[model samples]
Target: MAASLAAPAPAKGAWLETWLAAAPAASGELALVQQRGREALRQQPIPSSRNEDWRFTDLALLQTLPLTAASPAPAALPEVASGALRLNWNGSSDPLVDQALPAGLQQLSADEIAQGLGHTLAAAGCEQHWPVELNHAAAEHVLALRVTSRSQVSLELVSAAGAGLQALRLLLLLEEKAELDLSQLIEAQGSGLHSLVIEAHLARGARLSHGLVALGQADAALLAHVAMEQEPESEAQLSSVMSGWGLARLEPRAVQVDGAAHTTLRGLQVVDGQRIADTHSFVEFKGPEGQLDQLHKAVAAGQGRSVFNGAVRVPRAAQRTNAAQLSRNLLLSDRARIDTKPELEIVADDVKCAHGATVSSLQTDELFYLQSRGIDADQAAALLQRAFCEEVLRELPAAARSWCSLERLLEAAV
Candidate 1:
């Protein structure tokens, strides 16, 4: 049986208080938000295995991480493409300083930021999540922007963490008929905690395509939340890939405010050694004619563990909704573990909803055929793994695809 999270033991209650007390005082544009987050943390217990959403995840790695803010250290980053805008964030300095933005993109005004900061999170129903709270408590600044109507833009945001807590926050608002392609890269250099929260609002006829690639070391942990709200005629495509984190939890939620929107989600995660990777995703259609297509894949080797829970909701008002979700996993070792659940709740009789999950290893016949064709056993296995991951990796934007590849992901898993 799982113990209560409120238990005063070392791993449950006391550690949170200690960590909060050690954190720096909040005083900035985000001061009130930070205070609220601290209060929420104090009121709630650290999420434990007792929580259904976190049942397969362990929070012990966070106790071993530094609780203070991370200092800005120089990073070695990839060069930017000729026509693309690139921003390097150290989790402290303003990436917009002395930079010029293209015609379609502009920094949000103070009033706009205040009004739109948490709207999508609230719409997606994840504003108070523990990871979001952690990000709110530590994040000092936000990168807020708006894409003007009928404008098209491409951007790349990169962050590399050192030894401490790194918090990243972003808010994006896309106007009617606007389009934006955003590629984000996060790399962990040493032992620490990296927390991130992103909220995006897509107006009517707007489109947003986002790709995220995260690579971490075994001593570090990551928590990330992405929430999106879509108006009718809008579209959202999100693809994420994560590898090599000691512990990682990613939650991506989307809501079609009045339905009639299109949403596509793709995710791939690879874990080796004793690492853990978990992804929980949710999508809801509130009105008629919404569509969703989602696929999640995981590869677990050694004694690693992988978990995925995907939920889709179609309410009574959401007639003519079409949604499908699939979870596929690969187990490479006897001790590796995988937990996958794809759930759909539909109250509308006219809606078509489907969900399924599959777990399997490399096909013996395929491996034999590869070995018979003169490929070594190890190389054959790697070929199969690469093929498995490419399905999702190919969905990334061109710029983001250049930042990570199957070879790099495979190497990181080791």
Candidate 2:
């Protein structure tokens, strides 16, 4: 059973107080949700080395940040072609749409959203994580999207930063037979903290593909959490690329309410200097005939560090399930570090599940093979690195795969 968010003492700590003072006021259902979030934070202490889930990542810098609300800033929408929904957030809401939305897609207002907030929160199992509660407490807006058609649509979420904390919340629902292609770009420009929570629900026969890119300043910190619920015959694919943050953590969780659902997760992280990038994922199958394919790759240069932990759970009822998880990493410097753990837990009698993790440096033989072909050492290394990352990058949607910014991101890594 999840922990109860009953009446509790007000949250303490300078960071909590700063966030509360800067946050905007809410009323009615929204206010109640915020209060519950506050109580949850008060009841549970901050995570530290004592917690197994967070042992590998340090939180000293996060604890000392002046975590206030992000101040409003003017942001121009990115240059996206028509037929895309662009949402720019610089402590305010600016939605740019070049084309009209398809028939079954609509955005919900705060009051309209409150009607279904309870079920949405419950379905996401929000009580299990603290960062989610913090997001609920500080998020200034609740951007809710509902899709009910078989049409293809694009969504972009852009987050601009201020001097303090930036919190954002998103809820997405897809009815039966619906399809959506979503992309999110987060850019933090200053020395502060950013938190985001995304809750998604996919009904039977629904399909969703999500892509995310996170770029942060040298002194910035980021924490992003995603929760998804899938019904029978539903499918979801999540692809993420992250870099440039001083400290960052990305957690994605999915649960299959019924069986026969398909879930795919792919992630790539490139970090250098003193940056730290961490990703943790969890997928649970509750019924039979479920399938999951997961791959996570990381490249660490200079004195950077990369961490990954992925787990898939199949209960007794989840018979005939097929799941595979792999984590591959590369280290370019002696001082760089990579920690990866891929896990599978199965209680079913008949199921196929496999998990493996590998950590190595650029192979001398492979590098030599490329260099011998008339390519300079630097160019050869870059070529090899790009090849290493392409395995996961190719899994993105074609539109996202063709983005020039993504090409620049890979070049910058080299």
Per-residue lDDT of 160-264 in model 1, one digit per residue for the tens?
Answer: 878888999999999999999999998888789999999999999999999999998898899999999999999999999999899999999999999999999
Indicate the TM-score of model 1: 0.96
lDDT of 2: 0.78
- Measured against the true structure, the TM-scores of the candidates, in listed sequence, are 0.96, 0.89
lDDT tens digits, residue span 126-204, model 2: 5447777887676656667888767567766667776788877777888898998887777666778888888888999
Cα lDDT for residue 340, candidate 1: 97
Q: Highest lDDT among the candidates is held by which one?
A: 1
Cα lDDT, model 1, residue 192: 90
- List clashing residue pairs in candidate 2: none
Clashing pairs in 1: none
What's the lDDT for candidate 1?
A: 0.91
